[model samples]
Target: MSKICIVYHSGYGHTERLARAVERGAKSVEGTLVRTLSVDQVETHWSELDGADALIFGTPTYMGGVSAPFKAFLDSTGSRWASQAWKDKLAAGFTNSGSPSGDKFNTLVQLADVAAQHGMLWVSLGLLPRAPGPDGLELNRAGFFLGAGAQSPHGAPEVEAPPPQDLATGFALGARVARAAVRWKIAAGQPPTELATRA
Candidate 1:
């Protein structure tokens, strides 16, 4: 079975919702095992994460980058990187903020950079990079090709926001990771038993 772990830090529960969508998408695939862990739990769950086929990160954008807690989570992987524990593993990221142009790409880039530091393969969202719109040309509303990007409603509960498009975008990101992980594993001699395309 292919395993995908989603590690995330949610400041106001919005990112948590995005993470859930991602998890749901990943879990949709047959023979795929998925896990979602908050940033605070990474220390204890690091082993499980390291053993996974793919690790997808989610974090809220603060200032022009990821939140402090998520940064701490990334920093915690220093020893893991030193040993190249995640080498050859797949990596992707997602981020959320209050505004559409919150410089969220910086956070995704940082996540990808950290993954690279661990010798992991980075996965893109595989969508076009046009401006966000509810149109056929831009299925991912944030125009995020590097990773999923979400815009949450400021001062509103997560239940009331993040827009449907963002949630769907998050789901697509997770599904993409799962699909890629299975393909990679199969190519590495770990044949996936009839893996279905869930995305």
Candidate 2:
């Protein structure tokens, strides 16, 4: 079975809700085991993270970048980077902000950089942005290709913000990462000669 872990930091409930949506999507894939870990809980979940076939990261974009807490979590993975413990693992990320263009792409770049530093493979959202319908809801509304991007109106409560459309986008990202991880696992088990032949 493929194992996927989602690690995120949610300053408010909005990002946490997105994380749950991602979790649900990852769980939708058969033969996949999913786990969600908040930044605060990472201290005790190192083993789980190390063992995951893929790691999906999520964070709130604060002041044009990743939140301080999420940065801290990324920094804490220094040892993993040093030992290349996460090498060859699949990595994906998602972020939420208050505006449509809150410099959120910078946050995704930072997340991808962390994954690169650990020698992991990065997964794109693999979704196309949709034009807003009459109801003003659409998948990949943010038009982000690096990773999933979500927006919550300023001052809006988590219960109503991010809307259903953004949540669906996050779900698509999760499922994509899980499916990629499964394929990666299968490929890793193949004999080098056979893999080369297929290539």
Candidate 3:
């Protein structure tokens, strides 16, 4: 079975909601096991993270980047980076902010950089932006390809913010990562020459 773990920080619960949507999508894939870990809880979940085949990161965008707590969590992975513990693992990220143009892309870049530092493969959102419709609920509405991006109105509760479209986009990201992980696992078991020939 392939294992997927989602690690995230939610300043006001919006990001957490998005993380859950991602978890649901990963679980939709048969033979996949999924888990979600809050940044605060990672101290005790290192083993779980290490065992995952793929990791999906989520965080709130604050001041054009990831929030302080999420940054701390990233920093805490220094030892993992040095050991290349996550090397060859698939990685993906999602972020949410109070405005559509909250410089959220920077947050995704930061997450991708972290994954790169750990020698992990990064997964793109693999979605195209949809024009605004009558209900304004369109997947990839924010037009970000690096990772999933979501906008939550200021002061809006988690249930109301990150509307259905962004959540759906997050789900797609998770499913994509999970599928990639499964394929990667299968490839890893093949002979080097066989893999090269297929490539």
Model 3 residue 42 CA deviation (Å) reads 0.6
lDDT against the true structure, each candidate = 0.87, 0.92, 0.90
Write model 1 residue lDDT over 1-199, tens digit each, in one string.
9999999999878899999999998988877899999999888887889789999999999999999999988888888888998999999999999888799989999998998999999999987754353444345777888999998867766455677778778887888899999898888885455674442
Pairs that clash in candidate 1: none
TM-score of each: 0.88, 0.93, 0.92
Could you give the candidate ranking by lDDT, starting with the highest? Answer: 2, 3, 1
lDDT of 1 at 92: 96
Model 3 C-alpha lDDT per residue in residues 1-199, reported as the tens digit of each score: 8999999999878899899989988888887899899999999999999999999999999999999999999999999999899999999999999989799999999999999999999999988887343355678889999999998989645457788888888888888888898898898777899667899
How far residue 91's Cα lies from its native spot in candidate 2, in Å, is: 0.1
Show how many residue pairs clash in every candidate, following the order shown.
Answer: 0, 0, 0
Q: Indicate the TM-score of model 3.
A: 0.92
* 1 against 3, candidate with superior TM-score: 3
| lDDT top scorer | 2
Error of 2 at 114 (Å): 0.8
Better of 2 and 3 by lDDT: 2
Tens digits of per-residue lDDT for model 2, 1-199: 9999999999877899899989998998998999999999999999999999999999999999999999999999998999999999999999999999899999999999999999999999898787453356688988999999999989756457688899988888899898898899998887899657899
